[model samples]
Target: MTSIPKTSRRDFLKLAAAAGGGLVLGFHWESAEAKIMNVIHGGTVAGSDISFNSYLSISPDDVITIFSPNPELGQNIKTSFPMIVAEELDADWTKVHVQQAMLDTKKYERQVTGGSGAIPHSWERLRKAGATARYMLMEAAAKRWSVPASSLTAEHGVVYHKESGRKATYGELATDASAIAVPADVKLKDKKDFKLIGTAVRNVDSKQMITGKPLYGLDFYREGMLFAMLQRPPAFGTKIKSVDAAAAKAMPGIVDVVTFKNNVAVVGKSTWQVNKARKALKVEYEPDGAAALESTTDHDQIFKKLLDSSDPNVVSVKRKDGDADAAFKTAAKVITKEYQCPFLSHSPLEPMNFFAHVRPDGVELVGPSQTPDMARNETAKLLNIPPEQITLELTRLGGGFGRRLKADYVLEAAELSSLIKAPVKVIWTREDDMTGGSYRPAVRYRFSAALDAKGNLVGYKLRGVGINAGNCTREDNFPSGAVDNLQIESIEHKSPITTGAWRAPITNFLAFAEQAFIDEVAMAAGKDPVAFRLDLLAKAKTTPVGAIKYDIDRMKGVIDLVVEKSQWGKKKGVSQGFSVYFSHRSYVAQVAEIEMKKGKPVLEKIHAAADCGVVVNISGANQQVRGGVTDGLGHALFGSLTFKDGAAEQKNFNNYRLIRMKEVPAIDVHFVNNGIDPTGLGEPALPPTGGAVANALFKALGKRLYNQPFTKQEELKGVSLGERL
Candidate 1:
């Protein structure tokens, strides 16, 4: 029997003990793989060594583990990323297991998961990771059989010598393959040769998730760890004045109370006790007295003032092609409309939380974060230590939607743990997450179109005003290249209230406003909405236009697919709306169908078509499309956030409306496979949904809505389409 090394992961934990005698957490792939390898070998090779790479490991018993480097925010990248590797590896899907990789900047680049860039950024790298492994295995087999590597073929974790009728499992050759030199370049499988890329593979974590297993950051725990809850300023533009924690300290289960920055934190034995004590503590806050924070009403007036003003300080031209003023002056008719969208909260299912142990020797931080690399670096900066001293592990995120891209929660846990000199888990109450600001910036847009006497579009103009958000216009986006004279301008209001990226960012609401404006212009031009868009695309494809950012062919591809799939004009007695948008490098088109219920318009179904290149996993792709569309529709119809005196007016679901399960319309998803590299799917489908629903609603009600949360309009106020049904 071979002698296996005894210096395991647990032993290393003992090696890295802190000054206070607490164990410092560390992870090594070999030490962690021992138990898993044992199971695969049926307790035979429990102590045997395995061949592994930075991204993958192959046990002698045929268990192939692929490490997914990107953070998973329910985007299914965890499953789909590995599928990309497995497809190129030609590994059997049944023998594969996926694990989330810890933060290692040297091992993997771009670990962040926001902007739906994970797949597109990692596609080639992951494919090469697998192909390199397969190439090494083939080389090993070729050496053993005395045949050229070019003649040896690898398939489904096996190397075969077809001429000699000899075959060996990848497990049997893994040891030799480990010694083989990895080729600098290996051929990637053609898309048509893939068996797993387009297949509907089940999510690896589905069973564990459905069984209510402990997987998310909230579920993480450490021995001798204390739970913490924070008491932050009640409203934006406020700072802590005083803290009285005497009564809180007397409360049962209370451990200690401390203040950091401008916030008070309560430490206790249990979450319930910590939460109860946190609320019991008395904390006073005074006005920060910086720039006056703008309420929703203030933003409304500010946006109105900036829309028509050309103040050099507030307004700047984003893009200009030809002379828009000259074209508008010569036009026969000009149509103008203004649209507004309120601030929105991410409201992911899981509230913010993180676990941290700030030991002297090293730091162990674990939690759900969309940007784990940033969290690690920020924590290191806060501790005044090198980033390599920190070992950060990622847990499955309950929900992110770009909210976890910020490291405030993670930093809080790190700072609290450092302050208390113990392992700590910080938890945020639903109220805390909601009231703690990081909202989508509220924005307003004014669009004007000029038409010639022949009913052809001659010029276009757009001016957007946003609170705290910079440059709220996608100047190079669709329709920019289609018009002869175009101008886009942006105005910014520097409000004190904090706001950050939310899902699709500016395009989330911009798509709706722009698409709805296009619908209106189409009506004014006496043309069908779909035909009008197609005409613009055709002009963009053929005519000389100033720098188009989107692919005209892909946009038209999705538009054609959606039109064909939805039977756009074939359905009778049903009001239909059409919208198409290109965002995040992907093109999406949607058609919303509304059937009249009494006098109210009830959304019956939505058809979505996307051209995001090749679909890695059909099941996950479909889920993303459906989820995005549902989220977009719900927010367009009911989502709204307002501020009063620099404080969020709605704190919980009761006041902050979300679309009910009963309100979700049936959604059908289709993908256009053009054999190109995958782009973004998580957010592309969402941007067009609002426009589709709004356009359909216009047809149903014979009135155009210029603002979001259409329910806020006088015609829709207090009217529930669900209640009508």
Candidate 2:
């Protein structure tokens, strides 16, 4: 059971008086402190000076509107977030309305939604918002009936006096409730009493989404809005030298052409017209000052050099425990392997786009942004306007996968709008979206493990090399805490190629590298992969080394569950592989079942066990886990983004591969309901999937794959869902 700290009744009364003495029934809660007060009365807002710090509003007619403060990047936070508030409020599910709140730092904390943080960040505050409103309703009923507030119980949007057989709907008491003193503290429902959280609720926007409703940033429209398409440098480390837009401006439907920074923008009445004109524009490029013009070949050679280099300038120790050198010296066997994954394009279904209306007095911005607060701040800095003068609204994002975290596209729209003195919607074509340099950094990991003559693991070492990846090693994750002697180091090459977070960030590929290497070591030790991992976990639980950031129990729980669900060793004719990872404070374990068909490995199914604390909207949670697994598997199988002379070789889907329906394996998702606060679900399941599949592939192929895009290998090339032999 959880309890919310109360704001004293006396303090709330003082706040009401300060807000002109009307009924103010909500508290502006921030990081365990109720700093301000706000209220709405009879469906009209009452406090202008007050920051609406709460997530919900109750009006006459008992309608409750819950505001989802974070961006919905196809993660279903739009539905699940409000479900949490409604559950705590004990409000009727049918009567709850959810709205996407605009960017307001004071009203909502942590408006950014990347890193699977939306639920974990806002969980307690949303629950308290509901409880507070429920408390107010009960107080209003107590005042009307001349009874003690404690004598009335609130449930399902009603205040009831059981002893007297009296009841009042929240709608009937809303007006009076708005005037009641805000409660300082309220009791939260225990986990056993959760009514809506564990249940599967369909996406709130499913109906609108399926019926072709205009909901995404691409669907956004304004009466006089102009469409824009930009021509950026053809390759990384290049900038615009000169532009010839006369031919583009002569095209029909093309309103104007402009240049800003390194981009040339063609603004027109429609996307089609702008795209046609954009192709007509002639632009010259020059090498950017001091930025290296690199290619995939260059990066490959660089990674190899850095992995071998001992220069302190190239390698930085991320974590070091007992001397690894001594442990390896006494070991009977040493297993060394190198794993590589290429830079990847986010390739969201909806390409990058945003709408900006920059006016003299204020700015009206609307689009799909995973970090609206960051976008707003960056836009303010670019436009030389106060942040307060900007109003940003969020639209349903088609997909993000961490690409929207950057405000580059948002700034593009704002800059064009400001220059043209009109509202503009900046749209990136599929070619632009893919070739644009904000890619997942190409990374390589070298792992060496030492085992004693008795077959017990003694030492582990990792050296990571990456292009523009700030920190490539997850120093504290897994084997770090379990191993006796461990050393993790990172080597970075600052390429001119831009890179940023993609899904689970470094863990997306690192988990695979670490787990695959662990599997190899287990094989060398003649131990079952599952049993080997469990033994290490047990050792860590009993006597951990250094600092352990992950919850051992949670990780073990998922591993056990996946083993049971996948029937690990019981299923014949199928090669089985196991992997578990902890990220974003959530644990996920996956088992991939593979079978050789027509001399190639075909992934048959994946069984996944996730411990994301208490499940909120089980349907959405299942989809998230399954989607992450599929994404990870597809990328590992056939995704690669290579550069030739700093130009991305793959421009669109034709060359850049994605999983097809036939190739996607069936996935079973199971969640552990430990009745704890929800952690992130968006990225946790993704990290372990690649490792699981690769381990399974090893079992089926009798060989190890050391690089991603397993298709790159001569034998695995064109591997797909081949028919069973």
Candidate 3:
């Protein structure tokens, strides 16, 4: 059971003996939140007690505490999610305190963050939660005033009796409010009535960040903790034959050099000591087959290979419209283009780290993890403890971009500490973090289309190859089935490297490539790209993206809104090209102006627009929009991770360049100002940027760029032309 404090800027502390001596409770709401008057109950969402801690909480002090289950990796959900509930709670924005909800899946299940689905998925549930609490408080006040519920009105955390001019604050009714059963169907406010939502709000935690409060995993601290760094294989499929730990064991602060699982780990009093000892320790091993992996696979080659190859196991076909094959066969003119994007890394500012205290009965984990649900299960497996005994304490993330979802590092920490018989924290150096694996799987995409005798639209076809995304961001459970005629296939060039979710999952990369190709088709047909996309959306919405893809109408609505905002088909610069893409239930369109100077592409400006249904925490949503766009720009310019003789060639930022301040052109973001519940604006904004830039580049150069390492053609020198674009 939880209790709300009666004073402003206070806290609700739970002090149960954790089944047998667990964590202590201490929390405080900042003074700024004392004026909040919203009553928001977390339970009764979809009629379940399991998710009570998910959306929002209230204290007797009038402080509104909003729960954001997902990790805050500088994307600003800390502010966005709260603004959503605040809109319905009628809580004064000045009195709201956004809380970092723990990684308790049983309490706030589905806390894992990725797919840009955080806010959109939680929108209705959170709003409904707030609305229900308001109803409960209103009922309590209505009874006290002996007035009809209809006659009593609530605003800004206060319930008022209009006729009598009497009022009771939501906090004053908190005690009585808790005793009542939740109304069967709490009434929600109409969209037009919203105040906080659909409005740009500043980030709730920005001040804390600028002030250097302990927010991310990098700032995590524990009493008497030992640090460890794992020694991974130099290449995939290789194992250490033996290790020389003599030098490491003698080093100061070096606790022990031990082997866990297949890798050697050096433990120390500090990260620097552990890292220093790791370098001093030497090992030899038998390398894997990927040792011969090369950066030589050019764009055109792999794209064609994916098309002509017959390796099945294509798990999904997301979308297809009309008789594509027949249209292509009968067309008067046919143009086929191929595209390729190399592997990428999440490379979050804070590299992966985890703190674990392993006891005989169970384990406790502290640090940042996107999926606490998965963490519980995986930690249970590694610790050989009951799933119930494992407790996960999630902290704020420096960054994720889909990397923290995997619980490998958490398990590793627990396993190492359990053996050492002490609390331990595992830290990855920038080098270890990069080489440790689980990167975005590189992909090859091929697109083809046909134009009729009249040059009207006839058909579209797509073939994708390389590592399958099913290995990571599996959407088999999505509302819509996978693609159609879409022919999404894969061939695994398995390496020792592990791969997991990155950004919007594998479908998004395909969307970026496939959508850009479709844009080209529309241009070849002399049809407006926006209108052409709408036609496809109409078919997909009515039909479906094969079995399941996503909400088609919602997707189209966003795209349409973007076109209206971005002035689709209007030329900013005749040489600039534009494209649009949809992912995670959001649509984004970008028109990039580019110029070819001495064979180098220079982007001049970008106009971006999106429809996320509703806008929550305007500042945070806009930040994500801008950040995701810039992330795409960096990738389009020079970000490409390739393998050579089974080793990743691009070691760090020097070679794997990100978009710097100088490269970022003027980016303009506009939203569909509707308070129709909240939707997210993270990864959805990224998928379209590359395609838009590529399309723009084509418009400027009069030739298509269908390969990655955009300018690293030398790597593909000896590679087969079919495998190199």
Q: Give per-residue CA lDDT, model 2, range 134-222, as digits (tens).
A: 77778889999999988988788888999999999877786677666666677888879999988988888887778887788999999
Better of 2 and 3 by lDDT: 2
lDDT of each: 0.83, 0.84, 0.66
If candidate 1 were superposed on the true structure by all CA atoms, what would the RMSD be? 5.8
For model 2, give the RMSD to the true fold: 4.9
Cα lDDT tens digits for candidate 1, 1-725: 01111123333223222111210111122222111121122222223432332336566666666667678879998889778878887887788777677777765667788888888887787787777778777888999999998888878888999999999987787666755654646788889999889989888888878888778899887889999999988778889888999999999999899999988999999999998888788898888988575588988888889997967877889999999999999999999999999999999999999999999999999999999999999999999999999988888899998889999999999999999999999999888888885989999999999999987899999999988889899999989999999999998888877889998999999999999999999999999999999999999999947998999999999999999999998999899999999889999999999998776678899999999999999999999999999889888888998988888888999899988888888899999989999997988999999899889988987778889898888756665565411
> For candidate 1, which ten residues in a row score worst on lDDT?
18-27
TM-scores for every candidate against the unseen true structure: 0.92, 0.94, 0.84
RMSD for all candidates, in order, please. Answer: 5.8, 4.9, 7.0
**Model 1, residue 150: displacement in angstroms?**
4.4
User: How much lDDT does candidate 2 score?
Assistant: 0.84
Find the candidate with the highest lDDT and give its number: 2
Better by TM-score, candidate 2 or 1:
2
Clashing pairs in 1: none
Q: Rank the candidate models, highest lDDT first.
A: 2, 1, 3
